[model samples]
Target: MSAQIKNGTILLAEPFMLDPNFKRSTVLVVEHNPEGSLGFIMNRRVNMRVDALAKEFPEFDAPVYFGGPVGTDTVHYLHRKGDLLEGSDEVMEGIFWGGNYEKLRFLIDQKLITPYDIRFFVGYSGWSDSQLQEELEGGSWVTARMDPNYLFKSDPEKLWSQVMENKGDTFSVIASMREEPSYN
Candidate 1:
């Protein structure tokens, strides 16, 4: 765990992580440092439509997601065109986070970007840096390098299972296991 977890890394929750919000979840770590860590849950989707959000915040149009149970009022976005905007930081090679709001608005208005091109999250999942490292060591999370393709997945509901399956046969076995095992 000597290496620091940074943006774009995928965090897979361990089988025993009982927190209902995070169990069997895959998260994209968007920020990390000594101060704390921040990320969004990749598998949770809110029923809200992009057009609905666009109507509410006519200045911006994007897809919405359940980031986590934390700060539900704050908005965060993950994007592939992140480099084009100031303050955007590359989470992985083709993915980034935190960019200019005006630029986002322009992209949305021009139809240059679609809801599938970026994900909007309300609030975010956070962990103190030490806490995250501890969780990693405890086998509460499996860290993997991220690919931008995973972030813009068309079917987020299947993203978690797909990621776990990609990890290999061992993880595949885990993915197939029932949440609550039955005794015959």
Candidate 2:
């Protein structure tokens, strides 16, 4: 509760969290305000792709991320193609979420935006006003500074622990723990 949460902060799930949707999840907070907060789970890559779901979309091959349990019917995206994608809102330094959809297709078709420059999500994680604050108070998450490069550059399977490891010291120790500790 005392931590200063803001857009671009990485929300790391606490070790051994029980929520199946969020255990070992790493989320990028895209919006924060009195109304609520919204973000996409950065580490969960679903077994699907953009063009697979929408044949109309150009033949773009890339991993489709599972943003969260909310709004599975819709698609959302995060990217670093600020001006190239146009009308994008900066979630933080170097990271931008959303823009003109038509322009996105055009950029994808023209090869102006590469897979390295963006990530698509099936849905997003949302928190309502006091809900996030309550979660923070309840020890469900740990906040860390974001290095936007980590989004596209880091291995998704290791993201949660990798990010936690980057925080150093005790966090590194925690990161070394197996996800299913009982097996050990």
Candidate 3:
């Protein structure tokens, strides 16, 4: 595995990847170790809200996202409230993943955590030992530095292309290609 790829790294699926679950997806690495790697697909938003997933969840407008193809029965979260949310693991400088669930609900109830301050996800992207290394070596993914704004300030709809373009050089050109090109 490249030293650059680690916890909090951003993995951009190669533009032509064929996997339905990851094609054009922007993934945020939450953990990477000798055992394996795990991340959340940052760009695959689902047409639902967090409140719809559980009866106990407070009524909120936070959109739910398809984190990846693994653990569909689970729910996870990323937030910018590292200072205020207890038990949050910092994925990067200003981004935190997972925290006290009851505290989260309480914060939401008090309007202390806004939808813009957090994102809810279902499932997660994961790889077995050396699986992610093999995938990275095979050119299936491109790495980028994580920026908190990408999650809290930017639009998920354009995250893949936006990150690709930000990489500059050949990546900028790749970012400009149409998702489905037609050669006439």
Candidate 4:
């Protein structure tokens, strides 16, 4: 396995990942390095409403996403406005992650940023340095470069299947299979 995963890519877990949190999950790899990896689950949608968060933070406005199983209470965000803010890091081409509450508030108040332009996530996927590398070697994930269009997709419910289908013939077949293949 490569020591580092190319940034701004998708990590699709193999069907064998029995962990309910990750089974058939699609993750956006925002950071991958010797220090471990961090990403947000792109497929899972929380039941919470954006207005609820907007009321709570008042300063920030963005739709929340299900990051992963870890740090469920923590909030994170991904945006294309990396260059406009301090402390933001690019995870892939045209995609950036991190939070600057003050800057976010300013952007929101000025109407410079909106929920449509960014995604908020609760918690994040984390791997101990070297742990992700091992998983890669074990075939737990298949990596693909990121697509900006997918990041801001309006319909996340189909995003996972869409991504897997784009992986070419092999994954297309898998994507077409029914979730309960045994019944077929």
What tens digits encode model 2's per-residue C-alpha lDDT throughout 17-122?
9999999999999999999999999999989888897657998988899999999888888999887877899998899999999999899999998889889998
TM-scores, all models, native as reference: 0.87, 0.96, 0.96, 0.88
TM-score of predicted structure 4? 0.88
Cα RMSD, each candidate: 2.5, 1.1, 1.4, 2.3
> Model 3, range 149-174, lDDT digits (tens) per residue?
99888889999999999999999999
Number of the candidate with higher lDDT, 1 or 2 = 2
Q: What is the alpha-carbon lDDT for the whole of candidate 1?
A: 0.77
Clashes of 2: 0
Task: Compute the lDDT for candidate 2.
Answer: 0.90
lDDT of 2 at 29: 93
Candidate 2 residue pairs that clash: none
Model 2 weakest 10-residue run by lDDT: 47-56
Candidate 1 structure quality by residue, lDDT tens digits, 33-90? 7898989998788877555654335444455888888898777888878756677888
lDDT of 3 at 178: 81
Question: All models: lDDT?
Answer: 0.77, 0.90, 0.92, 0.78
- Per-residue lDDT over 1-184 for candidate 4, one digit per residue giving the tens place of the 0 to 100 score: 5724857768888755788888778899887777878889987878775557654455544557789989987888888888877788888778888868778767767878877778888889989888888888989888776788887864687777788888888988776666665754
User: Residue 106 in candidate 2 has what lDDT?
Assistant: 90
For every model shown, the clashing-pair count is 0, 0, 0, 0
For model 3 the local lDDT of residue 130 reads 89
